[model samples]
Target: MGDGLPDLPPLFGPVFALREGGDALARAVALAPEHGAGCFVWVRAYARVEAAVVLEPEQPLAAARPALLAAAAAMADALAALGPPQAEIALRWPATLVVNRGVVGAARLAAPPGAAETAVPAWLAVGVEVRRALPPGVEPGTDPGRTALEEEGFDEADTAELTAAWARHLMTGLNEWQERGFARLAGRYLGWLERDPAQAGAARRGLDSATGDLVLQRPDGALTRRSLRAAVAEGVA
Candidate 1:
């Protein structure tokens, strides 16, 4: 772990910084069962980054989806705070984060393999990674659909600062979820979802608080649901 990490809130035990090429999510997941919750790990790989926090929930694993979503929303809020006023930060369904309409980062959730949905796992991990700087020899316009923080005018926001901000914001988000209920967190997350203007009138989409599923409703009264848990299990975005 690296030094000089900002003071974290009470819920987060310590900030463990992984060396170059280290996988934060993998380390956190491996240690979670033993260390339990409040263990946060992060890695600052050149232009890429990785982070994960361990969580221990009293509720069953199936009911823990809200916690994961709240963590992702907190991360989004952290990025939004560091970004310029006009910069657009949004979530792409379950995991990806879009900035200025371009892909910049993503979040992931993990638990023990084959852990029963109805049983609380020994531990859970929520990991996130964002591109801090452009890759070498990569021009701004080379990949218009993708972007890095520096390329998007966030030159002052480095990986360390963002990681610290994420910890603080995540603490706030979890507290709000506990006090105000999941609806409040869900509403904030929904606001950050990107939507196409042309399809705005075609259907309405929302997140199911209970199961963390994407619910879509059409004008014809047809409803479709996509499960976040299933996506996590299948390792799909």
Candidate 2:
């Protein structure tokens, strides 16, 4: 705890700090059923913000999947505040964070074993990590298509503050989801979502309300759906 990850806001407590090698997602999943909600896991690291939080959803796992979208959008909100003005923060589909068009990091989700799509999950955990800098030998811009906060003019970015902000924003987003509906959260998420590189602007994409799938609407109005469920099965990251 010496590295100074700020204390998370109220409601996120029973904080569990782990070693640099800890997997926030895995640890949170292990703790979820016993801890219930508001359990937090912060993976200690200097070059990255690695953390996860647990949420107990009232809805079924399938319908609750957009919680990942909400988490991603919350991250977008958190990064927007930490980055320099004019820095573009966006999401690539479900939960990948993009800053100034570089792949910074991503959010991933997990549920208890045997949690069915139709049955309410015992608990859901959303984990996120964003790079603060490149590894030792890699020079900036020497590596294309990826970036970290330091290289992107995030001079004021602090992993501690970023972690705090992400949690608070996530709280706010989940609150909005409870007050309004998935549409509200989905719209906010999709607003910052960028088109897939392979099909940029070739179609308009939106989140499926019932299931959090990525729906692409072609100019001709034909629709193609990318299953979020399948994506999660493959890997949410």
The number of the candidate with the highest lDDT is 2
Q: Per-residue lDDT of 1-237 in model 2, one digit per residue for the tens? A: 324667677888778888877898898889888887999988777799888999999999999988888888999999888778899998987689999889999989988887889999888999898888899999988868999988888888677788888998999999999999887898889888887765555567777878999888888888878888987888855
- The positional error of residue 24 in candidate 1, measured at the CA in angstroms, is 0.5
Instruction: Write the residue-wise lDDT of candidate 1 on 97-192 in tens digits.
Output: 888988988888888888887897788888888888877888897888999888788867767778888888888877777789777777877777
Give the C-alpha miss distance for residue 178 in model 2, angstroms.
Answer: 0.9
TM-score of each: 0.91, 0.94
Residue pairs with backbone atoms closer than 3 Å in model 2 (clashes): none
Prediction 1 global C-alpha lDDT: 0.79
Model 1: worst 10 consecutive residues (lDDT sum): 193-202
**Regions of candidate 1 where Cα sits further than 4 Å from its true position:** 196-203
User: How far does residue 24 in candidate 2 sit from its true spot (Å)?
Assistant: 1.2
